[model samples]
Target: MFFHLNLLSVFRGVLYSDNSQGQDGVDIYGPIDGGTAFSGIQCKNRKLNLIDGSPNRISNIDVQSEIEKAKKFKPALKKLIIATSLPKDKAIEEFVRLQSMEHVKVGLFTIQICFWEFFERKIPEFETVYNWYVKNEGFHRIKQLSVTFKDGSVEMTYHPKFQKTVDRYIIPPTNNTAPDINPYTSSLANLLQSDINKMMQPGYNSIFRSTLLLSNTIDWEQLCWLELLVSNIGQAVVEDYKIELSLEGFFEKAEPERGNVLFNPDFHNDIKGYRNSNSHLYIEPRKKILVQGDSFVTGSFYIQPAIAVEAEIKLNWKLLSRDFTDSGTLIVKIVPQYHVIINRHEVLDSTDVREEISYSLIKRKGTYNIGSIDYHDKESDYPVS
Candidate 1:
């Protein structure tokens, strides 16, 4: 309504009062022609009587009481306007005129009653204020959310360790086996040894990359890095906010070895994510107060997903704030990175090569079976029974 009053030029240099204790019954006050004297307005909104279709009237006594209160206002009001939603009344107008004349005669301020008819006639002249309050147009809030990746793309690539297996042959210390050592098996051992050294590096242990990964139990601080940007494009402010995020897609159970691995050691300093029984994570706002046209970026966090095949994942998010709520979904492309890791070697059989050797790789996924291999040399002096 201040905008409406501005357009009507009701008062120059108008200012709204705090309306707190000892306001002197003036909701708004302003100067007139740069003079010492000021004019004030007191608003009274009254409900209409349902049976009579008439608003509760303001009595002459009520006017007299407000006039007394306005007299206490600083700068000394030269005129006081009592604005109400109630329709006009002839008795009230006549009472106000007689009271104004009587007050003017005694060096008091003049009194005026502005009824609903005064504003109703001028509303159509100003479309902006009219549409805002009456038509409920041109008023809305815009919510936007964006995900930030290290490589500036929606796809996340993770290379988890795969169970390693090695094959080795030992020649028995005997007089007959001394000169028949196989060089092929010797070179194979050296190759497997080199692969084992690479697995001991840092990236091989990158298990806590994402908090979204399915785990029976995981340390919240060990998850991988995932960042998000939140923005508010409305005119109002958002305060006391809470955000909920959940990943939606098919997830395979991760191996216990991979699930227990920790990501960044400094994750303890940031806000820890709370995961519920259903795998939904609740995150607190880093900034408690979000003003209009402002944006905030969340700290780096982990998002672990246990998926073997390439697939599209949806990040469903919801924001809750004081008197406002919003929800949205973001699509993320997840590409699984697979690297062969030779963990350990197993001795299939302890007997001589004349005996058959057979074995299978243990605790391994996505590997073709090496099956059984015959170690017995056809031309060797040892005869097969």
Candidate 2:
């Protein structure tokens, strides 16, 4: 309860939780800025102790001693409070009033014996945020970070991280003649694909010669240096604040074939990556910033395209806050990029193309199955068709 209450104190802008422990007789202390009037709080969850000789449910003498210990705190407290979970009776309340008058008699200052009922009436939401902090960040929470940049561009992407990790596997072909992939077989189908890539250089092969048009699937296990830029374009708004970026249910496991950015060209090695790391930035007014660091490439959804050769663009963003969160998404048609090499060149030449075609048809237009996809200019019609 002490730890959570201090966390709540920091969240509400009362004080930052960077103080000494309660062993020195001070559990909660005001911020160094000393902005708020209230100075210290001694949170104690003591219940009524039933002693043999004691007729009273509460002990005023023990409470007074606790208050005395509080006075020994360095940098004299302005308003010392005895916040307790147990309720105070008429006897205890009267004793506290009389003790307040005896400032010289007792070294406590303006003592307020707060009951558990006080939180129920005032500052009710404190408990809720405290519980949430404990569940999410827990004892060691991620400190608030500041992100600043004129252009909101996430500079580098390294690895992909999420709540869970799962590997991406390629199901191979069962038979050498099969056109479709077989989950049970090696993705290579046989030793044929390995030989095809070796037969000729990447671009001159009978396969989707161009690396951009190689793969059958337009998929990305990771998108490096990819970050969503956020701008607060609004009507004359001036607020000095920061925001935290977190992705839930967003993940992608790295594949050796898909590969990753072993070294970040954009930022230093000590920088953060999108995956398994915190996404935080401080936006100044209408300015923008690039949310870049050491992390796995974030935001992954393997979208299956309707057309074989079609562009697929996906964008997702969220405006988060302590209260409510607003988000938006946009998906635009984009030209898919990939690399593919046909292991069975004889089958494609016989079934797909009846007549012989030039490398321009294969290189520029990619492998054609339907009507001879002849291109006017190698540059103009190359990857478009």
Candidate 3:
């Protein structure tokens, strides 16, 4: 069920024993004449071929012969691992055909197959084979699977269910010694020491300064800003087209001022040393504001903004987690008060309208206000029951 393959190497060593004359017996054994050699088999230089090189189809006899060869090699092998550089389709076909025989399904068959497909290779056709294996053999037995390339490797490891349960109940030794309290401070000290050494070395600081200067150049900053702007505006447009224009204008005007605002002394003073010292830095005061509304208006106002923040607009009406049909018209409008310039001209008037026609939020009474807006409808009619 499980297979592990390692590289093979042969080592020769001599077995020696102390030779001394004993009074009661003959001479003690000395070093042997012949040394024993060990041979270990390891797999290396793995490559996978996705495309079939030969026009010949693999015959059933060939599959049987391979199986017979495996059987012959079983006696001498402590662990048998098979690897194929073939494409997924060929591998799957071979695996299915080999495992299909009655003798191959026996308990003696313990060899595992490892398949790898490199870059530009087609996806493995092992889904069907895996499904069949799981259905018949169960997942508890299958062990290692790896899809590897020259640069990277991915392996699927199956944890045995029985072993997991056994490990869960197994108790581990506990240490009562207290752990290091200032690990982060110690790490920072080490880092600072290394940085000091680097800075003290001749020409290192110059190289570092040059690199930093190159990194922080205006052209680099402009390019980075442009990339950020493009990505942000593109994402905003894709997520919410209504806010795209506003986001674009915000990026254009605010980018140049970003470095000044971000690197300000006040800004640095606010967050600096807050992590090392156990002190809270209150940069801004939190204000408590009061809002009053009935339940129907309050719930709608609360739900809409919460959904809108995530770029989602809910169009369904639910009563007790069940969909309901209620006849009413609801209009939700988001109006930006700030002046947004588009195409060299400032447009002061732009409102995003979201309309919902439903019959759910009627005959309810509670106050609803989210941050700033108070949503209340005068047209709401309570049911006369």
Q: State which candidate has the highest TM-score.
A: 1
Could you give candidate 3's per-residue lDDT for residues 236-272 as a string of tens digits?
A: 1111111001111111121111213544544321111
What tens-digit string does per-residue lDDT give for candidate 1 at 1-385?
Answer: 5442533344333655655666686877877757777888877665433222233688899888888899898878898888776778889999999999999999988999888687667555656656654434222334343333434445555432221223344444546544443322223345444545655567864443221122221111112356667776665666667666666774431111112125533442222444333345555666687776777666554555552445566667776654456677766655543322222233446663232333222121122213322221122221111
Sorting all predicted structures by TM-score, with the top scorer first, yields: 1, 2, 3
Order the numbered candidates by lDDT, best leading.
1, 2, 3
* Model 3 regions lying over 4 Å from their true place: 1-61, 74-79, 90-107, 118-385
Q: What is the lDDT of residue 82 in candidate 3?
A: 36
- Kindly indicate the candidate among 2 and 3 with the higher TM-score: 2
lDDT of 2 by residue, 271-365 (tens): 22344433222112222222222112222122223222333333344333322234444343423332222222333222353333111112221
TM-score of each: 0.36, 0.27, 0.17
Model 2 accuracy (lDDT, Cα): 0.40
Q: How high a TM-score does candidate 3 get?
A: 0.17
Off by over 4 Å in 1: 1-161, 164-224, 233-236, 252-272, 307-311, 341-385
In model 1, where is the ten-residue run with the lowest total lDDT?
A: 211-220
Q: Cα RMSD to native, each candidate?
A: 17.9, 17.8, 32.4
Clashes of 1: 14
Off by over 4 Å in 2: 2-22, 31-38, 47-58, 104-108, 123-127, 130-385
